[model samples]
Target: MTTSPPASATPALPEPTPTQSEQYSLTHGKLTVGDYLPKASHDGKPGAGKCEWSSHVSVALTSDEIGALAWVLIDSVMKARFGPAVQLYDVWREHTLDGTTIPEPDRQTIGSFVKPVFGLPGADKKKSKDHLHGHIGEWLWHLLTKDNPTVRAQPAPKGDVTDSGGDGYTIYETANSELRFRLWESKKNTGKGSLSTSLNQAYGQLGEHGQTYVAKIVGAYAQASGEGAAELNSFITEIPRAWTQGDVIVGAGVTLATHRPLPNKPFKKMAGKLPLLDKPGQLRGLATSIECYEELADTVRRYAWTAL
Candidate 1:
């Protein structure tokens, strides 16, 4: 008879081999993603209509929601580059105002606020994935779940930031007082490949490295001040054990082709094999599929140019 391997002898998960990336040049005042339904046919017929998505899922593009998202993105960017407790308005004014005595930001100033995040040369370059991933994280924070500034501010680095790991993390209290940790990962497909490709990449990222990244960031924040810093710090020290002993939830955000229809049934069938951490009898396996216009980045830039 064979004996079971000891805990230490158990192998850590393997690293994820993400798909090859493509590079695209950034265009000014252009958007690459937005509301658009992909072309689909029922029984070999082509048509246009509302694509049925998972229940209760929709994107908010109203002025109010866009403005809120802008603020959050700006604040999160600053907090990640600098630290928490930063006043984003001041930072925006500092960079855009250039010593002017403007009490409030105008349209031009608003564009300036987002330039670092979206305006820089090649910010949304063809191969870049950070912008899409970071934006999805922000979208989930505001639209689906309660806000967590630290996770949102996790910095969309211009380069080499994806390796920074732990796209996002949050803590929740169960009815019985047990703690559960939720982690998120995102993938964007520029229509060069099927949506399934991006979804698979996201699921792989979460399974391979989500826990380690969360533990690292949580440990850092735990030493500082925040809503759950102290508790997170203690949890980090315990690590693999802490994660296994308690509940851990994983979320994946996939950006798919907007021109084609995505049926929920087949999508679920495909995702069934993912190594999600959502436990039995617990809310787990959170995901969102975003269909973007061909010019989402341009649209966002125009919005910022007009709104700020």
Candidate 2:
């Protein structure tokens, strides 16, 4: 009864500001997403301190050892088109540029060539999880592991006593998975540089549980560190920039088999939960299929060796 006219109704609270999209240009001028360029056009040349990652080839899989991953997947709703595989070389031979071999992987040949199940599941699923999983224990106990390639034995010049040193390797997706292991090719000949393989020594470089859901690229790009100096140069400069470079919206140019996956927005908003597969390029960056797998092999093949 005391107050004159009711105080002027307060203006309705301004609608909350919209989120800055990572995929498209922003509507309001002030905000924006990272780059959305193609993977090839973004990642610039890595300098000495920047940690360059070049290889003759790369292969990605969604697997827990026992070889490349076997995802129960297909490619029908395919939208973000994959670039055609550059037909410069035969994919298989290209993958072997670093002297690695898949061998004549028919059933018989593969059986003999397989070193051992190692940390992966056995050809038999139940047995694999029970036996191999147990044996791997603390080391391979990560949620999203990868079998990244490294030189089994560092190749020597001519035949200087022929020291058969090999590359080491390791798995990542969580925890100390970035570890490397060195092993000898000729365990009996224990010379100074004896042949051996071990996990890469970068385990401590990342967080025990890094955020990137790298466990997805299983369908294609077996995560081979096999890009050639130049081809790798092409990728770093192009894709990373598109995926997450400067002003433009970059593609993140991540491979499908990267241990980390991209993040998703729409799903999180509606479901009120964050999903590993919800990330932008999370499920994977590459398309998966028999052909694409082979194409990945081809791409690595071409990148590894120039003549091929």
Candidate 3:
């Protein structure tokens, strides 16, 4: 099943022209951002405090655009686990350096490296679904955070196997020049289940294990020797306390592929789920419902293999 904007809505934008780059870059101007939940409903609400409603954005993309995005992002996805200097990155840079097409042999080499990371094309059904859906959700959140101007987010750690910890992290600079850290957990609902239930699970996981997740990523912050590095490191070092002190923002988001209409209040139950961060602008929720999600995942996988 597929869902698209109504005829009265704005016309679909033209596809973007691909740019030549040494490193993978996000294809901007293609994502459609709109309100998923109303602001009036959240006012003075328990789980929904006075957070930046604008910050809670929803994204929609055409199938072709999604496939192209996967190609553009494959390098960064590879680098997330293998580092920036991976052989595949080198091969891509070399090919695009002269505006020439990558040779067939080179494409094969790229596919070889990519297939193992994502799993063979026709691998086990359960494992393949898990890898594809989980990575796609994380990737969507990464793109959203990167495009957001108010926060500087880290790329998700793309491990070959699932690991315990938060799904995403970011730093927000308040108007007062204070640094605030955010830990995010992302979930995807591929089954015929409730989106709120998935979100509740994400919040529960974060409430129980968010500290350990923050602790593990403290070293990654050390690489930021630029301004605010010291303060950021200190904030991350004190996890649960930082969350309590209003210096840390905890968020959870769920992505679903559905043809059904979304609930008017997707995140109404958030405050009751995890009441630790009840301050205004402290608890955040994102709900991304896409049409043909499983098909998109398959398309993304195909595009990734041919991205050389």
Best prediction by TM-score: 3
| Model 1, span 111-180: residue lDDT tens | 4545554553344344354464445434433334343333422323332234567555555554565455
Q: Give a tens-digit lDDT track for model 3, residues 142-247.
A: 6555656667446564554276566777777666765567777777777777776776787677777776777666645555567767766666666556654534
lDDT of 2 by residue, 93-173 (tens): 233333343334332332221212221123432232222211121111111112224322121111111222221112212
RMSD of each: 18.5, 23.8, 7.6
User: The CA-based lDDT of model 1 is what?
Assistant: 0.40
At residue 121, give the lDDT of candidate 1: 30
- TM-score, candidate 1, is 0.52
Each prediction's number of clashing residue pairs: 27, 89, 1
- How far in Å is the alpha carbon of 48 misplaced in model 1? 38
TM-score of each: 0.52, 0.19, 0.69
RMSD of 3: 7.6
